[model samples]
Target: MTSSFLQGKKGLVIGIANDQSIAYGCAKAFRQQGAELAVTYLNEKARPHVQPLAEELGAEIFAPCNVSHPGELEGVFEAIEARWGKLDFLLHSIAFCPMDDLHGRVVDSSAEGFKTAMDVSCHSFIRMAKLAEPLMAEGGSLLAVSYYGAEKVVSHYNVMGPVKAALETTGRYLAAELGPQQIRVNILSPGPIMTRAASGIGHFDELMHHAEEHTPVRHLADINDVGHAAAFLASDAARSISATTFYIDGGYHAISG
Candidate 1:
């Protein structure tokens, strides 16, 4: 269970906010399974929280990448190109919606809010995939994080629902477009967890409680569960898998209630 499934693999991991971030969990799992990483911090304010985690994982390239900053996203790939030369996989776990839009109904979400959410949460993955394609000389994986709300209605999950829906669909299309080159693309849909990102969602505690009570597993899945699943999907072990909305949600997606 702890073999070097990803030994020798190298790639960038964007969106690590802190030790509790889903990206951090996945990066930790990737490291434990022998994959070297290039991690990013959003800004100087986030640097302190993310620096130690990146160092703990022995990340080879730790850079500041606020995707909204012009050229910052491209700069991440550039650094990776310089340090690793080639990449095997990438994990994208960033999403954003203005607090007002996140708390408002989808129908009432402002055009700017919807656009901003889609741009950060969905389009960013496509951008990363496009940048990563040339570097993945030997077939590789491109993973994005999603949520069950993308498929079904969840209380207080407003604008992100549509944003994630777009994100999942984009992954499928990227998988198709990049499949010929042997670049596998997929999305990870995890159940509610107390992430800083999730804190933006209104009444998040109720969402977590609902997931814990209703999900068949009788508990919410943690970031580590997402990490292990992400590691497997990104590893050679999942070479044949692509364009999937892989769920690490304790089977909550299976419940219709």
Candidate 2:
């Protein structure tokens, strides 16, 4: 792999639950581009899954961070300061909604489930950007993952669709707020991909097949494609771009039945 793009850069990639995760793809691409990395797993349950991937990437740090908890977020930044002192990029790939809420009608979604989804999927990015701002003394890039469901409704995407809408809006607000400091903020929306998180949503396989058949490209996005898009967005090449969401989907958003 050519290694000129991200040499000597340092970044924190949050929300990597396992090797198959989109965050994992971003982390790998960052490594290949010569960026040093740090990754966060949610809790003890995710350590074994995250550890090998961290080691494989030669990550400078690995820490536990549950974005829902303020203390965990504080501790993560503390560790980053103690180790790297400053950061060049931050990736927010965290999001969650109760399984029960995901498979049902949006009107049927419970209040608690809606709140949980918004907190984890939307508010967390806002909190992360606030926390990361001070640490990025030299200015930096911030990237978050979203989905087409945030706009056009996807069956079984219920509460998460709303959460992603909030997330995308948050990205725009942060982009505007941080632009003066030269910190770029953007969102990458990937088409249906087979990750563990997607597995939790009902009928994901059928959704994937449907996307493949309808999208102009006639195939699904590979993890690396999404990662490469992220790497570019987080790199100097994308310095002038912010307050925008880039679709990494294979033209799935443009087709009409």
Candidate 3:
């Protein structure tokens, strides 16, 4: 709640679509903590949804970017350079999988779908970090969202589970490579939360219910829970922590039930 923690900080939040988005929550929380914000929308369809949110947040920079496109990624960094000169934080909350692949068994996942999932979910983070590293002259924090499915299979999570596993592995590698620069790379794995993307997964309601029932907190995590965790990890408070994946699943990952 106190803005002093992030006073004078600047950040870029990629993948905000609407208020319900985890990225949106992180953006809002970062702003409340006094961080200047910039946002990226994937395409024209999402622009309308993200623009108003950016406006509300008083974001100085709003750009259209597709992580799959190297040109777009370069443009985003260029825009950030033009506006802020340097970046203190980056939030990567982007992932994708074909709707058909999301409902099928992992064995049924097509090679193309699997590749697309890995490109979007896993590789993009690495690409983003590579691009952001130079701009983080004084060192910075990079945060990405993963899921419990990365380590344990969740029904219908399908190709995304593998993508997340790869993402976690990438995070560790990046942390090691970037630690000498004082740049931190970490993944936050949150339990099921009702987001636009979650709706596409089969039997999402049942998954939510199961998570809540089994978690020690007896409740599923909300966007704010994720947002706050991200803020802390992105802040000086977590300066010593790196090469780790923090589970924000309300202790669900530990429960056998």
RMSD of each: 1.3, 1.2, 1.3
The candidate 1 region of ten consecutive residues with least summed lDDT is: 1-10
How far does residue 142 in candidate 3 sit from its true spot (Å)?
0.6
lDDT for position 41 in model 3? 93
Name the TM-score of candidate 1.
0.98
Clashing pairs in 2: none
TM-score of 3: 0.97
Lowest-lDDT window of 10 residues in candidate 3? 1-10
The residue-by-residue lDDT of candidate 2 on 1-257, one tens digit each, is 45668988899999788878999999999999989998888989999999999999998888899977769988888888899898899999988888888877889999999999999888888888998898887789999999999998888788888889989999999999998989999999999989888899888899899999998989899778999999998898888999999999889999875
Better of 1 and 2 by lDDT: 1
Tell me the tens digit of each residue's lDDT in model 1 across 41-148.
999999999999999999999998887888999998999999888999999999999889988898899999999999999988888998998999888999999999
| Candidate 3 clashing pairs, residues 3+ apart or interchain | none
Model 3 lDDT, residue 187, Cα: 95
All candidates' TM-scores? 0.98, 0.97, 0.97
Q: Identify the runs in model 3 with alpha carbons over 4 angstroms from their true place.
A: 1-3
> Distance from true position, residue 41, model 2, in Å?
1.2
lDDT of 3 by residue, 170-252 (tens): 99999999999999999989999899888888888999999998999898889998999988988999999998899888899
